[model samples]
Target chain A: MNILYTKNISKSYGDFWALKDINIEVPKQSIFGLLGPNGAGKTTLIRIITQIIFADTGKVHFDGREINEEDVRKMGYLPEERGLYKKMKVGEHLIYLARLKGLSRNDALTKIKYWLNKFQITDWTDKKIEDLSKGMQQKIQFIATIIHDPSLIILDEPFSGFDPINVNIIKDEILKLKNKGATIIFSTHRMESVEELCDHIALINKSNVILYGSKQDIKQNHRSNTYTVDYIGEFRNTNGQFQITDQSETEEGYIRSNIRITNDQSPNELLSILIDEVEVHAFQEKIPTMNDIFISKVNEGTNA
Target chain B: MHNIFLIIQREYITRVRKKSFLIMSIVGPLLIASLWVVPIWLSTRETDQKTIEILDDSGFFKDEFIETSSLKFEYIQTDLVEAKTEVLSSENYGLLYIPRINLDEPEGITFFSGKNPSIEVIQDLEWAMKSVVEDIKLERSSIDQATLDSLKADIDIDMINMTESGEKAGSAGVATIIGYISALMIYFFIFVYGIQILRGVIEEKSSRIVEVIVSSVKPFHLMMGKILGVGAVGLTQYIIWLVLSIMITTGISSYFNIDRKDSLPVQTEQSGVIEEEQENEFVAEMFNSLESIDFSLLAFAFLLYFIGAYLLYGSLFAAIGSAVDNDADAQQFQLPVTIPLIFSLIVLTAILREPDGNLAFWLSMIPLFSPVIMMMRIPFGVPYWEIGLSLTLLIAGFVFTTWIASRIYRIGILMHGSKVNYRILGKWLFMKN
Candidate 1:
């Protein structure tokens, strides 16, 4: 079941189209990655869903109905250019945000206490936001994003200012939130995190969605029928059974080579040919990494 | 609506809790109270009486010189040289040497002193000598003092304003003062409170908190909340000032056993008992004129115009704040918004000069100028329909400016590091959200 989706979303700023004919669905209780390069209209699309800005022509459906101000309350948004009132205390700022998102004062206080204790920063609650360091502020912002217990949480560049340890903590929290049944839209240029956590992703390029689907399905579709083989010595007589796509030497004197199977040849046949030619150590299919797929797709867009 | 309230609460609480706000609240009443009490207090304190020694060679002015509280005249029998030495040696202020001359054309009446004598002293001495010569001349023409005194007429014209409710006693001086003061208060409040709105908007935009705010609530709500919040701060300060000022003034006045009705002439009596009678008459006339004014209507109009003008200008200031990244960038936009306000101030004297004139009518009809100009006319007894029409236009103007400002504000807050100009602001006004 889809928790939120956009249909035929298009937006323009004068002559420049920021988004065009965009469509995506965020499934229930799953991590969704919204990947795009700088100025590729990702923020614009996020704003539309948050109702900060209007789309020239589009409809955003949350749960079973069209998105409204009420629905916006059920969704939490942490913008990329996020900030808190410097003069306000951490507890006050969080409570203000939670109340703005439709939580009662008591509920906001309880949730804030719970989150602060969970993050082990309960002592920092009374301190001003300006007094906190950047990493601390990032954690506070992260807590603010979900303090209202929103069903759909959108975090833009959520890990930008966090250290590795905090990033792992946040990643764990995100996974835990998902496990407890919340749909997450994680928008960022970082592909490694998308690979690690995102169950689904939509890659936008130049105001268009260039690639989108389940992570497994996309990785499957981009596969070029290639496999890597690690061997001790190079016996290059394949008898045209496969084509050598790339070859390199490992630091441990292992010949690491990649080969694409020829017409209708399965992995078993390729492995049989490789064993006969050299002392085979390891063999594996070469599935493309998200980073590689992103670069290539973006490059193709630029070239086109 | 709830989000707007939260925004307002935050804005108001943050500002009211500030050190500056506390300082201003305490200082504002003292300043206003001093403005009222200081002049009266100073006037009541006795000034040093300067004694002038007169060496009248004509011998016709010996009895004419009279002593007043601030100026005393002493007739000396010595010659001019001796008088000068005696005046310099003594603690007298100056020596007045009156040379005997023909009564038809008096000339060269020199007064010697250590420094330049005040014009009041010189005029006082001259009037004394001239009156003596005039009495002598009248005697020479066979006219008695009683006849001359009876022939002199002192005419006082009581201005009676003819209105639909019959003739009403009015004083132009009192109206001018009231009109000018109310107009100035309106002008002062708009600038002080309007800039607060601007700075608030700039702070949010520069700190990048506006996006997080807009995501939860509408930009319109945020702008209005800020404007109303700052306005509430202004109103609170004004009320505290009013209460404190009244308390201080009453406390001081009662402690000194001073009655407001008798205070002015009593202070003037110490300077010159001769002017005391005239001062009392003028004070009484001013009090009568105050009675003729409808304070309730004036206050209602003031409240209406104050809020209308503030809302009108406050939104514009907010828009300017949103459009710029900092106070430095706001100068260009601020100029146009402030021009009308400054223009009203420049023409305030002219408006008061002829409160019901064509210039006043047209300027007060324009919403930008009406808050100040109409206020100036209100104390002078404006026609009810004219006031109503101006107020309606002002309300309409506020609505229109707020609409334009919100349009620009919603877009401007999100646009950072872009050099904004009037043309770009114009574009943003029409840009879709």
Candidate 2:
């Protein structure tokens, strides 16, 4: 089931279109990647969905009803511009934010404590936010954002300040939220994280979606007409029937060569010939990763 | 509504818990009370009103003034040389020599104290010298002492201001004095606390904590909370000062009754009958002044004005807070908000002179100035319609300002680094979003 939807949503300031005709759907219990470079309408969409800024021309529907004020109570938004009351203690600040999200005071307190302990920052409860380092503060902010147990979580660049270990911790928490049937919109430029976490993604460029789909589908759609073969019987560095873009011989006397089909011969025909000539070990098609797809899509967009 | 309450609670607790607020709340009233009470006490306790002798060169007036415990007068022969010599050598505090005056000419007086004569002594000697001149003229006209005494004594005018209500007589000066003070206190607390809310918002915005808090609650709630919370604190301080002032003023008045003759003024005087006519005029002056104060009305009016004025300006200050992004920008908004408050105070003070006049009536009806002007007018007897109308306007003004401020707060808060001026803010008000 679709948990969140944006249909032809666009926001503009005078002449600059912050988000232009953006359309996307967040499925339930999925960690969806919202991929964009800086200034690519990601934050704009986030603000609109969070109801902080109204869309210039579009509609947002959460759980099949038109977005209204009370919908924010069920949504958690962690903005790119992070802020906390520097004079206030970490635990108190989290609880306050939680209560603002419509949790009872007691419920907020319990959740804040649980999150703080789960994040292993239990000792930081009494410490002022200003006294904490940037990473620690980021952790506190992260805990505050999720402590309400919001169903629809929109995080914009949530991993900007985290180290590798903490990044994995947050990644696990995000996936855990997804496992708990919460739909998540994780926006960032880190393609490696998209590969690891996102089940589906929408790559936006210049206020337009250049490519979007399930991670597997998007990558598979970009595969080139190339194939690689590994055989034990016979294969030369340079081939006559095919163009060997590159080749190498293994220590076990098996030859691995990357072959680009010059003619419109099918993979099966090439495989039969390979089977006839040499003892076939492995023959597989190469598929593009999300990083390659993202770059190529951005460049393709610029060119188009 | 609960969110607003929470916001208000946060505002009150955070601010009231501060050491600065706690210290100022206690110290402000203490300082004001000390100012009101200490000087009066010090003046009464001094016991050193220096006595000076006058040597009038006007041959028509040659009597020494008088002599008593702290004062002495010596009549010198109409010799400037002898008087100057005596003044330079005598133990008397000063020699006030009034130059001979043709009844038509202004008198040129000289003070020959060892040092400069105090202003009070010089002024007292001037009043006394006038009497001697009048006596000489009476003697010249062959009027006997009995007729002269009767003529010179002020005929008490029995003022009867009656219109089917009981007749009451009051000194115009005392009424005006009370009216002026009532108006001024109402003005002071409103502007003081209103600006406090503005300054506090600027401080929070400058530190960027507003963004954090904004995420949790609406900016309108935060602005209203701060204004109401600060106003409550300010009123608390005001009540403390009022109590302290009443205690000290009443305590000292009872402790040192100047009329009891034990106050030392009577002891310092040469005689009870400074002259028979002088005694009668002084008694009439005291009774004439005491009838003007309507303490009950004064207290009642002050409460209404205090609450109304604080809410009126506080709501405006809250708007000013939301209109600006930072303190530097708040200066522009500050002038517009504070100008009305200060102008109201200025107008209120002026109306004290004629609280029942046309200017006071119109100003009292105005929402911005009414809280203060009405307070001043109350001492001079305002009608029920006037108080009701003025207070109603003040309440309405607060509600209107609160709505406007909330709208500004909603838009301005999310915008950062963008300078919002009058033009932008004005447009923001009309924009539907």
Number of the top-ranking candidate, with DockQ as the measure: 1
CA lDDT of B54 in candidate 1?
80
Off by over 4 Å in 1: A229-263, A267-283, B51-58, B73-123, B133-144, B254-274
List pairs with backbone clashes in candidate 1: none
Question: Taking the tens digit of each residue's C-alpha lDDT, what string does model 2 give over B1-433?
Answer: 6667766666666667778876876677667767756665665666554556667667555543665333456666657767777776867787767776777465576778778766656665666666766776777789888888687654656554442356666565566667777777777787778778887776666555565556556677778777777877777667777786677666766776544233222222324465444555545654655554556767876787787777777877766776676677788778877776678776765676667789888887777778777766775677777888877887887777777777776766666677777888776676544
Candidate maximizing lDDT = 1
Report, to 2 decimal places, the DockQ of model 2.
0.32
* Lowest summed lDDT window (length 10), candidate 2 chain A: A234-243
The per-residue C-alpha lDDT of model 1 at residue A179 equals 97
lDDT of each: 0.89, 0.74
| CAPRI verdict (incorrect, acceptable, medium, high) for model 1 | medium
Clashes of each: 0, 0
lDDT of 1 by residue, A40-84 (tens): 999999999999999999899999889988888888888899788
